[model samples]
Target: MKRIIIASVAAAALVGGGTAFAVASDGTDSARSSSTAFQATAARASLSDAAHAALKAVPGTLDSIERDHGRWEADVLGQDGTWHEVTLDANAKVIDQRVDRDTDAEDAAEAKALRNADVSATEAARKASSGTVTSVEFDDDRTPVWEVETVTNHKERDLTVDAHSGKVTQAPADDDHGDDDSGDDD
Candidate 1:
């Protein structure tokens, strides 16, 4: 009876130890997930703020804006028909500005689209959805349109807004179209 009692206690202890280890590992995973979610939230907020700041500093049509390595970079077509590459700090402060004089065929196409656009980048983004705008650019369609990429509830979505009419539509999938370089680069 004494030996049986000792064996039962030892088995119970072994099972209990395994349970504790599993619980601890699960808790660590949960903590990591929480941390990652928090970082994404922070990045979304900063991107919006930085975009606004970039437009204010450059005072032109915003072509594209993206966050890279803790900084925000914006490509803007100035009112004077010049392209400006604006870089801002994480705090939305302007840090660098450069004029892109090397205009390629793609650049010319984008500029033409922007010129024909009745809606601004901000308006296109607003019409796209009530989500965090990650990037916005002109699509190389025959008709002027804006491609707005957004993130909502951790899901990414692509939307196209008519540059002339402000109409919004779902963007086409990669496989849905062929390499027809109609000047629309998504």
Candidate 2:
């Protein structure tokens, strides 16, 4: 009788452990499916749509818009003379917005550049490539250009379009991940 009881308990524990493992595996699969769905939705989003959504939500002048980490982020100069950071979901829905209290000279310069830019973000994206635009931001490089990122055939391409002349050029690869190989902090 004692031996039978021990065997029964052991079998029950093994079955319970297997059931738990199956449940955990299903949970992982569900999470993966949800993530894939989100990426698909984000892929359908366009720079134009995200810009419109951000502007509508914040009621401000769009300084820059970029798709980062599966969401759309926009920097805008509010009518109140304050900078704002707006985050939008994959569907271009405003998810969160915050005032940029730590405004700096760079922010002002970007705004000024946007005001003087002859090529609109939409225009730059159109001229840059036929790929899906992921980001559009004005870079105040020596020549001043609109840096655009796009995904074509599952590959990311970075191009710079002249802010004034609308000329497009392939941007040099940015392999430096803050390594500072030159050993110069400045």
Candidate 3:
């Protein structure tokens, strides 16, 4: 029943017929380019040693990562079990850092949930798609799944994997994000 809910959510989030990707036949540039872009992002992600270095600078457990506004952004769980949003430049220099928006209670819950995840972020990204992992998170599900984001072929993608079962599902792109390239290097 839970898997059913998960599948339903994914089908609604990704595409018709409970599929993980949009078929080329869909003919929407947004749809087709997303996959292509993902490939591009994935292709390029592995080359960013700076993002990795920025991640290592964080003083705790790592959470999720993603590229936004032309920079590699990450969420790290500190040794105190708090989440921090960190950004790194192309040279891997830390350009910004701050505490995550979640409340301390939320942080505690996420930290506790992190221990049960059998799949690491790198493994989860590889299983979801061929790219560099940008971010990872423990979903708010009762069972707690891993929500991982990756960049490949100059595209972005989201994948959800069961923390214990290793079940993976690719999500559809929702670009309605009100974010902008304020931090992007122009």
Candidate 4:
């Protein structure tokens, strides 16, 4: 009798453990499949004309369109000669726009400024170290600012320069460090 009871209990434990394992595995697989299906469905929807028209006003070809946080983000080029990051609604209507101006404008402004309190590109770059002029634009106050991306001492940095004074208005250390050196290390 004792032997029979022990055998029954062992068998029951084995069956229960197997059942639990199967359930957990099946749940994970189903969740992944469903998420993939949803993404595929969303991708099939075409962009609306309103979105295209808004982007057309900006310069450069459309680089990419992505669905982000219930909004569509379109990256376009602007006449000012820099990339513009635009956000649109799901229906393809413009929600917000951020203009990135060319660096040349800052250089030219800095040079002119130095000649006569006029800002020029050389002076702006010199003040902020070396980086490609990405964009130059005026804020609401009409203060011209230059945005630059550069590498110094092997570290990448970004700077916002006052176009008139050729002074750094803001400087932010880049978090994306050692990216280019990664592949070489391996």
TM-score of each: 0.65, 0.69, 0.55, 0.29
Top-lDDT structure, candidate number? 2
User: With candidate 3 superimposed using the best TM-score fit, by how many Å does residue 170's alpha carbon deviate from the native?
Assistant: 3.4
Q: How many steric clashes does model 2 contain? A: 0
The parts of candidate 2 lying over 4 Å away from their true place are: 1-43, 175-186
Instruction: List candidate 3 segments past 4 Å from native.
Output: 1-51, 100-102, 131-135, 150-157, 172-186
Per-residue lDDT value at 138 in model 3:
62
Number of the top TM-score candidate:
2
Per-residue error (Å), model 4, residue 124: 38
Ranked by TM-score, top first: 2, 1, 3, 4
Cα displacement (Å) at residue 134, model 4: 27
RMSD of each: 13.8, 11.8, 15.9, 18.2
| Candidates, ranked, lDDT | 2, 1, 3, 4
Q: Say which prediction, candidate 1 or candidate 3, comes out ahead on TM-score.
A: 1
- Give each model's whole-structure lDDT: 0.72, 0.75, 0.61, 0.47
What is the clash count of model 4? Answer: 16
